[model samples]
Target: MRNWESFLRGLLISLVALVGCWLVAGPTAHAATSAPQTPTSPPTSILGINLTGGFTQQPIDSNVISGHSVTLSAKGTRNILETATNPLGSRKYVWWESTDGGSTYQQVGTNSTTYTFTAPEVTKDTPLMFQCEYDFTGLGLFYNEWSRIATVTVTPDRVPTTDIQVSADSNTLYNGESTTVHATLTPDNATDPVTWTSSNPSLASVDAYGNVTAANTSSTMDGTANDHGTVTITGTSNGRSDSTKITVGALQNVTVNEGSDATFTLNNLPDGMTVANWYKVDDGTTTALNSTASSYTVSKTTVGGDNGTAYYATLNYTVNGSTKTVNTNAALLTVNKSGLLSLTAVPNFNFGSTDVASVSQDNTTLENLDEATSGSNYDGNDNGELSVMDSRETGGDWTLTASLSPFALSDGDTGQLSAVILDLYDPTARLDENIPATNTATKIYTSSDYDGQTFDVTDSQLSFAADPKITAGDYQSTVTWTLSVAPS
Candidate 1:
């Protein structure tokens, strides 16, 4: 019984050993059917895209920058969506880029990688695109697509401008004269055209091409001879515009009277000037008229005078083109009436006389020499006195005379008479103190018959030469005196 039991135990041990060996071997060929299944379709698929969400063309992004845009990025897509998984290997992703918008595509990179592309031209019509995919064939073939489309835009550059000029034929415009002006408009950019406009059409007019014409219209320009108008021209081009202005006028009218009324028209005068007009009236009328000439004559008309018949005149002028007028401005003229003054005279007047030159000899010699004894009485001396002869006074036309009359002078002794007029009216008068000879007085003569000589005096009375011819008449002259003496 012991031998049989040992044999059976050995067999049981061999069976256990065989089972352990089989369990130690690798999976069977059919083990794959019992493995966990891998998905055939990807969890996410790309349907559309957003060019700029967080993606940007700018290199930095702490804060948004101006004048820049974000680059293309995908929209409605999940970056973490599941792709087919392989038991032994990691899944890889692929990406593509396109320059012509999204018309066509090309492979750019592989594996789960970010795709970068050369920036497209920034223009209004430029196009660009991007796409991505994953290869999951190890477990199950699948793809997660992401894409974006875009266009480039370009900015603009420009500005506006204008030009102005003026011209006239003459510096001076008459009251009835006119002139023309030309203005040319040039723009900075030829492509951006300009339109022309004016401010005052009444004062002046400008054509479409900028030709200006001056119209004879009334104006209120300060300091202008005549009120006139002004013109403003504007040029517009692109998005901007500019303007300029001009003034017009003529010389003002010259005035004659202060309170006179008259409307006078002038022609052919310089512009922006002020002057006065000459005015005059004819005898027998109160109406005054302005002369086209610079000077004018006055007639007996308009003057408020009696039947005596007299004439008056006036001139007109303007100052700084002002309205103030000077009445009957008689700047240059004189009126005379006859017999306005009278005259008188006084004559002889005993002008004091002085002793002419004289020489006396003493003949009182003791007649008989005392030695001869007889004492004779003989003594003689000549006593002479000279006096002014007469005094005459007259009121109506009278005359005063001065002369050198010689009398009792030695006939052949050769004597002269010189009378120095000391005083003509009063003999005892203080002549030098009261009246003196004037350098400007006209001289009168002592002759009766009025002679051509208004004055005459003896050259040398001592020599008894010719007596000065004297006369008196309507002596129209200043006061005068003479020096005279007679030789004895």
Candidate 2:
């Protein structure tokens, strides 16, 4: 009873003392107005990168030969390249290389919009990882947080490509244009190499690969009456050689717009040579047209096949009373790309203000373009975008072509940039982004490509040098962008 009484007395004394102190301290320091707490923003960028999915296209997986280098590219999600308000496309690219299969990365490149890396020094079985990032340093905004990990695998060099054979997509190559000389090697895994060389380089030239391009000239080739003559292209591998006879001439592929009447005809045929029959080849099957006339016309309604459906004729000629058959070169059929296809946008190339530069400048470049804005004219810090929309209403292989018109002076002056050419290279296109398996083509300049879908050439490398000694004035030119339907 005594202990309880003492505890109660002590508690009563403590409460009385606390009340006395609070009365003296004027509301116990909890009184008076407190300042409002302003909320701070989360973040606009992380380490100079907008991590909210800022990249539209990133580098993909690639397989390269042992000694070759692979270029990994990334495109930002922005519509335009650069502006006063936008520091996104200021061309600050850093490439990270991961040799241990993307576990850790090391900095490798700080070059242009694209980054390149040579082959790995280690075993190439594991795929290497590369990610391109845009670093803005002290700038408040960021362009790309990180890019898609571009996986690269280096293939074995070669087992010595033995036993090779060569063939051509077209027996006759048109001047200034090109045709692929498809080469087939035995053993499938044989990788030595098949070197292609032209006997008459003046008539035609063959590249390291088997692409044969004839010389461009208004004059007929070979001094033959029909503008047809053969150039020997030999492919050699391991002491074995296969020769392909490609007739170099001015045989333009037949283009039929919107299934219009396309007459399969040849001009300037020899007097003694007569056409035996016109063969329509489809899917490795051949059928005779049965008409022995010099030409055959395909009706508009009959043009239901794919573009580049071949129509070739066999000529029957008497050599010393023995009738022999010789097949003439193939003429590829093409349907017109009108309503079925359209070139929705073409971003003009602006070389910007330049001092008279004749020192051979391939360094001229344009920033990457993602979505093309309407009337989007890209200056030196420009966006050169080429877009094609294929509706699949009707058409052939959807092809988009661009040509540079002559430089016309803004002051109504007449002269030439003269041999100064602005070449657009390294254009990329995806047939359908919705379909992940569809191919992404890098060569969109003049190839028979794309169909039944829409896509954009996000970035095209544009470059040239102005004549150093030329007159100084503001000069402008228009790029002629054309759309056609041809088969691949």
Best-matching candidate per lDDT: 2
- TM-scores for the candidates: 0.19, 0.26
Model 1 lDDT per residue over 326-424, tens place: 222112122222221111222222112222222112111111111111112112111111122111121122233333222223223443332222222
- After the best TM-score superposition of candidate 1, give how far the Cα of residue 183 lies from its true spot, in angstroms: 3.2
- Report the lDDT of model 1 for residue 482: 44
Scored against the true structure, residue 142 in model 1 reaches a CA lDDT of 24
Reference-based lDDT, residue 404, model 1: 28
lDDT of 2 by residue, 230-347 (tens): 6899988777889888876433356755435777666555456677888776655677889898788876412245455766676776543567675654555677554545565555
Best by TM-score: 2
Ten-residue segment with the worst summed lDDT in candidate 1?
A: 55-64
